[model samples]
Target: MVHPDKASTDRTCSCRINTNYIPLKLLYLFFIGGQSCATTYRSLFMRHLGMSTQQTGVIWAFERVVSVIIPPFIGALSDKSRHPKAVLITLFLVGAVTLSSMYFVPQEESLNLTNSNVSASENVTAATHVDIEEYGQTFWLLVVLVFASSFSVVGIYPVLESTVLGVLGPQNRYKFGHQRLWASVGYGGAALIVGYLKDRSAESIGDMTGTNRAFLSMFAGVMVCYCCAAIVSAKLPVRVKRDHEGFRFQDLKIFLKKPDACAFLGLLFFYGIDSAILEIYLFWLAEVKFETPSFILGASTFIGAALDIPFCLAAGYLTKRFGHKTLLCFGLGVMALRTFLSAIVVNAWQLVATESLRGITWGLMFVVICSYTSKLSPKGLEASCMGIMQAFLFGIAYSVGALAGGAIFNLMGGEFLFILCGSATFVATVAFGMFSFLVKKKPYEMKDPGDCTSSLAFGKEVAESSADVL
Candidate 1:
């Protein structure tokens, strides 16, 4: 019934929508594959290589340093080129090759002293001996490969985040919760599978050699996933080309000028320390302190990740109703409690139970933080802002935490280390809560901004409720 010209216009609109929709679907798949490779098995593989706690911490800190240096540059490059997908594809391929090469690195079994009450200096001396006598060339090779792979892997995140944001546009940006849930599914699924494989390998083959073979299988699986992710990344389409002329460090001054932004970044920095400790130390705690089996350790990860799905799905609704500050404070408070409890756990089952808190603590916190940061970013500088924020959170804060955790683990042992981290997080929570209460918004902005006004009112309510405690 339509005229030929009208019909042609309708077809063009449909084609445009399809183009954007297809890329988003592919990007989701890429997340699934990428998370499977990166999150589920990296630390376990390192442990299997006979690296001591301090040695592992040093290596991880080096990776964080690379993350600090590279992601910003990659983000800037993508901003200029207007070819984020191309950049991502290249990074994925590089990551696949470098990470796969890690499988071939030789490892000699070192002294297992995780349970000893060794001094930090003593641990360092032991680690040095292992590096020289047992690790040697293979150790340096692994470090080199990690540096190279991390340069690419860390860079991929901001680009993927930008692409997802671009695809969703302003109107539906809040719906990012739905998209992120897929990553949780991917992590959980991979953790379960990898854990089962590791347990079976240990049972069938036996000894340190069996563990080595299991780790090799895990790395191989990661390579396959990376390859699939690269293929999917290559197919993504960039809809808009942002102007990149006159870009300079001065452009970042806007964030520094805002008091709220500074407070938020500080909060993120402290939270980063807590998070890094959990990621780096929890596995060792399980294997050494509690004598938990490989399958159970993997199951713990799967449980945490699986539980994240519901929290991620509900993030948007929760943020909308309770506001960012309340959710953030609540999540941090839960984290403090989790860490304190972790310090007291005597058995593997108790540790598993404590880990369930991760769903609320990390899951909700990350979603809210990402959304908040995205909303606060200056135009055309989303990727840069994200990169800088990540550098502070994962780079500086994580490095400090990792190194200190190792030293603390060696000097004072697990209980004291957890207590220290927990106390720090608790203090941060109180400081953040006080900041939220005392920092009144300017009167010049008389017009009520819905979320901002709601957040302020919520802060006032919380302040009143805890006045005596404060």
Candidate 2:
């Protein structure tokens, strides 16, 4: 009964929509798979390497900063040449190599400069089975190894994200939350397994030397996983041609002209530090509050990645419904509430509940944060926005926060340290909500090209409080 002309129009529309969603689906699967593989094992690797809480925190912050700083120029080059994939792939290859080296570096004892005065080296020395450093080569090699890793990732992550975004289109693009959720799933699975290993090994490898070997093995696992991810990354779909428009430093400057962009970055920056705080402290929290065995600490992380799936799926639905910023605000609220509740834990069971809280707060929030950022950048400006996000939030601020977290954890006394950590999350949540509110009196649609493909398609039509997700 439909008119012939209308039927033809409908057919064409359906065709375009199919064309749009299919590529994005593959892109999402690939991205999630690769990211999970990379983040999950990589996280376990860092934890195993005997990096101090302070060192790990700073490393995380620096990694973000370095990633932001270097990628723009590299991405600009890739963009100008119409080959975003070129730069991204090159970085991946480098990452595969650099990450491989970390496995061999000797694990060291986590530095406890701020730690409570405990038994000195001499007290444990007599009972210790073997010295961790025989030739001492492992200790010195660690510094070089980490530097390579930091450099390789800095080169790859932004470019990989930008290309994926570019290919997905604007409307109903690949979902960032979905991708992040999988990454967490990967992380959680590894954490749980490692938790059991650490727990079981404790009595057998009570010696520090034996424990170092187990930790070193974890680094090896990360390198293998990352190498595979790099190989998969090479096959992602992004055309290697510059667009009609030219890219220059001026394009990077466009971020300042967009308030939504600034506001989102501010939220991201604070949230980055807050999440970093949770990650660095979760194990310690487990030990102090639960009196848990090391095995339990390892077990909790085993589930970090798995738990992220629901949040990732939710992010997709939420981005389609309440919008990314609103979802982020909501997530932050949930996290702050969890942290505040955690401040009052009375038993080990309560500690387990706190881990769940940590996962939800940091893990799920990671989903929309990256996606919203992707949605707010102008075309070809994905790297710059990513860079700026890294520069402000993750790089210096987080690095400092990591250092501060360790200092404060030592200085403040554990009895009430939960309050301090919770306070940071709450403040960040408050800042995010307040600034987001004051940005506009009403909802408005604004589009920015992201590091995802779908952001370019239907999302091309941006609006406040509503999204054009297919």
Top candidate (TM-score): 1
Error of 1 at 118 (Å): 18
lDDT for each residue of candidate 2 in 91-204, tens digit (9 for 90 to 100): 656766765556555555433322346455442342121223231333346546656666666555556566655665443344444334445555565555555565565556
Alpha carbon lDDT of each predicted model:
0.70, 0.54
Angstrom error at residue 22, model 2: 10
Q: How many steric clashes between backbone atoms does each model show?
A: 0, 42
- For candidate 1, the lDDT comes to 0.70
TM-score for all predictions?
0.83, 0.73
Which runs in model 1 stand beyond 4 Å of their true positions? 1-36, 109-135, 242-247, 442-470
RMSD of each: 8.6, 6.6
Clashing pairs in 1: none
Model 1 — TM-score against the truth? 0.83
